[model samples]
Target: MAFRPLGRRAYGSIPHLPGSRTGPADRHLSPALARTLTQRARDARDHVVVLEKLDGSCVAAARVGDSLLALGREGQLAAHSANEARRLWATWVARHAERFLAVLRPGERVVGEWLALAHGTRYALPHEPFVAFDLMRDEARSPWREVTERLGNAGFVLPGLVHEGAPLAVEAVMERLGGAGFHGALDPVEGAVWRLERRDAQGVRVELLAKYVRPDKVDGSLLPENSGRPAHWNWRPEAPPPPPEMS
Candidate 1:
């Protein structure tokens, strides 16, 4: 499928700077183009899937020459800073470069999320790990399913998918968030993205995508509701509710 340029403002009004390759695999930092939430009702007869939204930042992994480059979502050279988390990620890629390359073709790029706490943030974890949720290739189509399989084979933990026909409502999403066995918190997120399988004008396979942020997180605050004020950032995991007793 041909790649259709995102709506002029769909990715924000930031003019494309020269020498910058804004391919789908590249991550940008346009707050104006934050992910939006979806209002589509779940179909009772169609399959629906739910995934745990990790509260980490974004990262991109690509095969650069004989090595791999791991970049932050904002297109920063992550290892330049004295951040220990960044160093750890760099080391991880170096150690696992061979495994990643087995699935990645030359010049291909893979997008993943990097979850870590910044300096002075109380939400810091003991270690830094990553989870890949998207992938892109240079010569071939974006094989998302293949990417997931490759990552799984490499022993990486990918997000889970729920398949059901029931419509996914905010309440349902919240319930999934509060369920047990997940590692992340249930704080308001930028929102979820819906991927639609379709072809573009060039007859190339592409995904019609949309993003939705929670009403509260829209303003860049972590508040549960948009209260028109800055709220404290909480990363502590909430205890799951107890199971109901037999009637």
Candidate 2:
């Protein structure tokens, strides 16, 4: 259940992002994806859904057989992770295991942000700390509409919805979000994720996923390593739980 990295944005680049280079191989958007984001999608069935990108640790709850396991970015058992943030994330996952198990099917995973520790932006989160953005099976992602309906129905707080329907410019999307985002971010949002979807007789196809990170946004500004200060926490569990049992 190793996480697949979200493709880089076709637009602006974050200073710290390795893939934000101008090389040909670093072009994150495919031809179809580029077309869809700039102008109307070629097919009538195609549409775009953009979600506000959060500054937090990426985590997932994967269904392994009958049990749900909390995983870090590289698919390591998060409960055993050397990183404190991931360990805390595992505890949070355990406290809310039933919610993940209720929504995930066999071999499926709910990938999202773990905001217990702030990265660049600190949050006074209005909802749960874990905010799911994708319902995935291996490298394949579920359609945006399905992801929203399914995860939303199961009490998952997803990233803020910036826009839906026709292709929109980054400036336009930012204007729509105003200054702060939906999840109660204290500072300006990092950026937005763009998911392109198309429906046909075969069902919904998740064409491509891209993101736009603000050029001026500093990476890990709130983190202890970056700031040379104490760690900044967005949320914390009441008590640290025992290490989770793993298969």
Candidate 3:
């Protein structure tokens, strides 16, 4: 499919930054969040959710005044004038800036994971731009439902959301992963991250409670086997995982 950016603009009016703000250079990076899980692999009582893990690299879009910044997963400034990935990211931002700006107020920022065509089967995916998962925000409310609804109306594909019960266990998470056949799947994704939504002094926040992955389920043939790469590398899951004993 030909990739089209969303119709939203960046920030229309610059709003005051929340709390004591610092320059972008001094801003602290968001930490990796995980989810909590319970024990019992086959038990449906465990709280867990599943979504298709898109095969692509990470991209983040932030608006400061009239300027819009696109950053790669490594926190480097994305330069479309030089790299293919940055060029694609720039196209995506241009197309979706309007809607993105609408969802995010001025001064406030929304951090999401961008999945594009770079490696594996997704490389052939036309256009190569879309938001896979929402990570964090500085807004007053959880804009997930609103942002997703807007994206849907604008004909943009937002990442899927599944709401499982509360108090999830490890066995239950593994059961869902096994049933999902995560490893056998053709997509080159690691697994899902667990999250919890709550309200605090900072408004509504979705916390990255944990990350989960079943190594046995991954398709080893697709990856560089015996290439002396870091064997302990784990896929960043959208939802966090339960403890090891739970699995």
Best by TM-score: 2
Tens digit per residue, CA lDDT, model 1, 92-117: 66667787787676666666655543
Query: 32 in model 3: Cα distance from truth in Å?
Result: 16
- Candidate 2 per-residue lDDT over residues 79-196, each given as its tens digit: 7866778988887888788888889898888888989998989889998889998888877889988888999998899899988898877777777777788989899888787778
Candidate 2, lDDT over the whole model: 0.77
Candidate 3: minimum summed lDDT over ten consecutive residues — where?
11-20
RMSD to truth, every model = 14.0, 5.4, 14.2
Residue 60: error of model 2 in Å?
A: 0.4
Ranking by TM-score: 2, 1, 3
**Lowest summed-lDDT stretch of 10 residues in model 1?**
4-13
**TM-score for each predicted model, relative to the true structure:** 0.55, 0.85, 0.53
- lDDT by residue for model 3 (162-228), tens: 3344545444444554432322233434444444554456554543234434344332333334334
Better of 1 and 3 by TM-score: 1
Over 4 Å off, model 2: 1-27, 30-32, 241-247
Name the TM-score of candidate 3. 0.53
